[model samples]
Target: MQPSLLTSNASHRQYRGPITTAIFDWAGTVLDFGCIAPVEAFRQVFSDAGVPITIAEARAPMGAAKREHIALILKEADVQARWQAHTGHASNEADVDALYKEFLRVDEINVAKYADLIPGALDTIAHLRARGIAVGSTTGYPREVMKNLIPLAAERNYKPDFVSTVSDVARGRPFPDMILANALALATPDVRGAVVVDDSPTGLLAGLASGMWAVGIAASGNEVGLSLAEWTALSPAEQQAHLTPARAKLERTGAHFVIDTIADLPAVIDAIEALLAAGERP
Candidate 1:
């Protein structure tokens, strides 16, 4: 389903260092600290539908396209049971489509309110740009949401060189389409020369499946699942306890590296370049 990290006959071929582009997932990776907007909207949609799914259920399918995300959430056993009990029938495709429409309306309305850039997001992008590394972005958000969100971010001087949305591609998270689209649009010298910085395991898998290095974001992203204020309110030990499993979860996704947030990304980029210099593949 994806290009191999290495060509069969090119085992001797080596990648050079200093990387080219860094692709980012939008919500938690760069802005909206805990990826709150979508989850809130998801919950609202379900509640409006009389199912009233929990936050965990809403967040469970966070990295897929909104419609696909709605489909995944509806596929949850408990959600299905609740749906049946509430409506006296199994949820069908029409329910999915209707809920997705509501999700779009709700999320698009709320996304701008959560568009604040994650701490160090702008700094990290600046640092990468200074070193001639192009910064690109991919997201599960559709164009309607981006229409509101992008200007908000740009108004704050945080804009990626390229932005690819779920609607821009045939498939979204856990699939390589969005990530590869970023690399291809950037004209990256090689796939391995690009990095994917994501907060979700699904996004990291997409990056790896695209043959790009992946850096998982733990604390500032979904794995920690806390708002910036809520996160900062925690004592050091509290945060540490959360990050342990967060790191492990992303690590299990086969990410080449994992760090707290985008602020910690530049150093990881340098580390990945060292691997590239040694002819290592992500």
Candidate 2:
């Protein structure tokens, strides 16, 4: 079912409190260095369907609901044309279903492998919690995948107070449902005072749509598309090649702030609090 949209009037209300909640995306924003699990799953699923997609193409729809991600790619003109050329027919819901099934199967097995917490993620969440901010999470992964991820992440000392998955909401990122769900779970009274941190355009848009401050993490995510080690190995000039475009895209999508990684988040939070003090509202 589609979630009821928050009325425009509701979104415009001013709130006077400090930020009480910080909702984050899972893979790219906090764990799974390089955000490689889903990307690899996308590649494998499409290639298995005889329609291979480039990494850029696979990453294009990152942060959407899994099935919707597949559908979005199919809707792309180039991807559609390629699908027809490969299969001798137009792609349809059936094709999406097949691809999504394969993706889920592949991802279920591989997600845990990439579940290592991104450096600074645990510390950042702990810092936020220590400041009396409630830590919550939203993710593109469904319940089944999260069933594995949640425990793994907790074992490594990186657990949020609440987790809202795609299955927990009617719609996923680019929509506000998941973020709103987090607010509901965190028992936050005002959405505007919460912060949403993510690494994808859709996730940023979701935060903006929810009238929350949106911070985009650039390097440690899909946009930069490099593992921590891989990113560190790149020459400064080479790294700029990735950071420039990724930061631009996130900004274009209305991210309030685009920083390098979650390690910089505390300062960003301080900046946000300062803005709130000055009567700013997201």
Candidate 3:
């Protein structure tokens, strides 16, 4: 006998409870002001290859698995033309491998340097915990890169209850595996009762794919492209100039809410609870 369709729907239940988990992306979303480490590493690798890329090009595929990130850059039309001109051939897996090796080397050294918790990240997590939310994290970095980072971040009071890295999943963001891993580790009741907070469109896409609320961090992260101190030093007009495009990009990518930094997260969580109370999902 065949199984009933109801059996499939049985495990597809939605939660009516208030949000129970807040899964965050690590670098830009929680630590490393302005998401500098990986972007710098990316720039270094490409420049060393004699095919330098602008910071914008380096950041264009932020939040993907490192190899996938390299692949995406290689696929860019201008980058592809440059690579062919430089190497006399189109980029391939070997080129990706070479770039990734350089990236890993540069990133391992720099990741610890940038491990300082973004201002207000610790307090925000504490506030979330006080509200009974379990905090989990996902990172584009593999476990090896995170080995130093996890401990460094914890020492700085920015630890999450659980962390899932690219090594822990078959695929990284724009795929839901990392966030699902967080939900499983946190024992979240349903995807509907969770939030995914990140600083990249790929991360937001992961949340949307997981049927969870997607919160984008704008000015304090990749989009604004400034260190915390640099951002603070900007005049109000300059700040607005950075924020307008960043916020628009996040909204365009389907973030349910966008805030400048983690410091603003607690209030957003409060608003999300109210929406949940109104029977909204995601």
Candidate 4:
């Protein structure tokens, strides 16, 4: 259900960067804990390679383009040592491809199975649109997933003005290609008029690199390492209870604002307006 807003005489203060458009990340940020399903798939491929990793451990590299994140994980986890112990062999390019294929399969199937908008997310998007802002979305989700999910999104009437995929970008998150593409689509006179809302390091990096204001969604059920089921089981109250720590953690990520939920979005917008009115950049 959409959030109800009572009409009031209060003025809608315009801010220099009150975010005329918002770009969203698909999986973990908007589409509910999508990283975990792909983790299970990667586990299968890695098991065949004689390396086993927990789904929890596997959620760490979210918001990055898969291949880029996998390369990062391989180096960080000393995959060479793991490979030596597991199969007395070094990791190969072919292993990466095999794991990638498995990961993509899980991502594809689970896009429908698990794709619920984050609580308050739809309402927040609606509120932004109601205020005359364009809403755009970009995702690490490849075009194949978009083929199914875009139709689903349209069925729900939460459609965005523009959508871009990681596959369409030269470099994905942490490089700003997808965010930049979405910003170009928004086409506002000032780049600051749009904001990127994200929950991961790579996403924040992308927003900052794109030179757009960034808001970090730091809701409780979305702490860095939780799986989908764990997040879903938390009641809204419980989720709100967890937001404090998430906010603190994300503050270090350099976001202009750290919001516990999309419900807090209006307040953040007000803050941005205050900043702009004072001739300060947010």
Give the candidates in order of TM-score, highest first.
1, 3, 2, 4
lDDT of 1 by residue, 194-264 (tens): 99999999999999899999899999888778999999999999999999999999999998899998999
Predicted candidate 4 versus true structure: per-residue lDDT over 1-282, tens digit per residue: 433342342234334555577787766566565345455555666676577766644656767677655655565555557866776666667767777777676667766666666667678887888888888887766787688888876766668898999899888878888877877777865666777877776787788787777888765223544555675688888766666666776777788887755556777776766776665654
**Cα-based TM-score, every candidate:** 0.95, 0.92, 0.93, 0.82
Task: Give candidate 2's whole-model lDDT.
Answer: 0.89
Tens digit per residue, CA lDDT, model 2, 1-282: 435545545545657668899999998889887899999989899988888889989998899998999999898899999999998998888988888888889998788788888888878888898899999999999998899889988899887989999998888888999999889888997887899999999999999999899999999999998988899999999999999999999999988999988988999999998888777888
lDDT of 1 at 44: 94
Cα RMSD (Å) per model?
3.6, 5.4, 3.3, 8.8
Q: Candidate 4 — which residues are off by over 4 angstroms?
A: 1-18, 33-35, 78-80, 220-222, 225-245
Q: What are the lDDT scores of the predictions, listed in order?
A: 0.89, 0.89, 0.89, 0.69
lDDT of 3 by residue, 2-105 (tens): 47876877545635568799999988889988999999889889999999998989999998998889999999999999999999999989989999888888
Worst 10 residues of 3 by lDDT: 8-17
